[model samples]
Target: MNNRILVTYASRAGSTAGVAEAIGKTLIGKGLQVDVLPMQDVKDLSPYRAVVAGSAIRGQKWLPEAMQFLSDHRSELSRKPFAAFMVCITLSMTNAGQYLEGLKSWMSPVRDLVHPVSEGYFAGALDFSKLPFSLNVLAMRFVVLIGVWKQGDHRDWSAIHAWAESLPSRLLQ
Candidate 1:
């Protein structure tokens, strides 16, 4: 039987969706049958042998849709070889270690709920222009004052690819 993997994500302004696509491409490159879909579009997880669920963190929490996806599929997910990933601006290059720690804490609840075989923390993009007006203004000001926020996509594509390529080996064992 062919091994199929579902790659699903929850994105607010498309950055996380880009991450999901990159992951899907990497998995496909490894000869795995993969489906990349949005969390809202995926109603069931029964068709795939493994799953990789990703979310964009907002205010230190998993996006509502993603959290619900996990809660809704907890039982099915528990039976498979699964992985979880989160994308966030907090993971920008300069503060990667700190951001990873925060991501770990934020994911703890869902991690316990799903008990995945592997998990990942990916750096995400921050386009102030795409953010809500109030948030954009605040983020801009914070960047100016703190001197840490650099505009442009900050995702580490290589790291994402490496993680995706390793999943099949991890799950099939």
Candidate 2:
């Protein structure tokens, strides 16, 4: 169908998945048919006219599974209208211009395989209980000792909805 789209994401601690669902809902509100699924669960792209892929960032990179999903579906994705989004703690620390410039490095690998018509960057949430104890300890050191991070939901929904509102034009045109 001309209006069909796929919104998929790879999430580590669930923030990215919530973002994907919100995106899918927004697309549906725009009268497009959409499916929001975990990246690993999407086996085919033929049913969708456009694909929106997203991921949670870790260690300055898109999670491995999200990268793998793009690589695995590169052929089909390169032929279709593909867009991407990323959720990261880094966004909370930068200005718009700086964030855009810096995140380019993170997308370099994806850019090599797919050119997204649009890209969305949103702040992500943090929950130590969702992470492994080792990582929890490390993150806590950064949070507690350095006073570098605060643990809480940091996603900007207004920004997210605004970005999603702009996508149909970019994806369906």
Candidate 3:
């Protein structure tokens, strides 16, 4: 059986990439073949048996490039098993009720194109240094208003690993 899985991601400040890498590593440890790459670098899905795509949440949506990738490959993605994950600081910090509502808005667009068998939402790192002055000020205000703790990397590796461990069965079917 084909167990080759593509773990592709689009990250802004590198948090989603880290999660993708963790998922890929965990899948490999479970005796599956995995390839982790940025979405733009993935040339073909033919070599992959299944795909796990993720992106960093920006402005309440997946990055444009990530959405475009899904749009470009919607047919192929729908024909095979596909999974998606997102990394956002505010998303992970919100309560369960708000999380589901926020997830619907964030994941709705992608779901319209492809149906993912599995989905993940994770807290990503926040690096204000990467933002310009104007955006930085706005981000700070958003953080303060949201009542988030000190800004920094907040990813949960164990949760990521657990999610990865559960994928082989879903992906390989």
Q: TM-score of each candidate?
A: 0.90, 0.92, 0.89
Checking candidate 3 for backbone clashes, the offending pairs are none
Superior candidate under TM-score, 1 versus 2: 2
Against the reference, the lDDT scores of all candidates come to 0.86, 0.88, 0.87
Over 24-79, each residue of candidate 1 has an lDDT whose tens digit, in order, gives: 99999988899999999998787899999999987778898899899999999999
Q: Give a tens-digit lDDT track for model 2, residues 15-126.
A: 9999999999999998989999998899999999999999998877898999999999999999999999999876775454576787878888878889999988889988
Candidate 3 lDDT tens digits, 1-173: 37789999998778899999999999999998899999999877888889999999877799999999999988889988999998877655646446666566688999999999999888888777776667745867687667764577889899899999999899898
Highest-scoring model, TM-score: 2
| Model 1, position 153: C-alpha lDDT score | 89
Local lDDT at 69 for model 3: 98
Q: All predictions: root-mean-square deviation over Cα? A: 2.1, 1.8, 2.2
Least accurate 10 contiguous residues by lDDT in model 3: 91-100
After superposing candidate 1 on the true structure, give the runs of residues whose Cα lies further than 4 Å from its correct spot.
Answer: 134-145
Ranking, lDDT, top scorer first: 2, 3, 1
Identify the candidate with maximal lDDT.
2
Candidate 2 shows a clash count of: 0
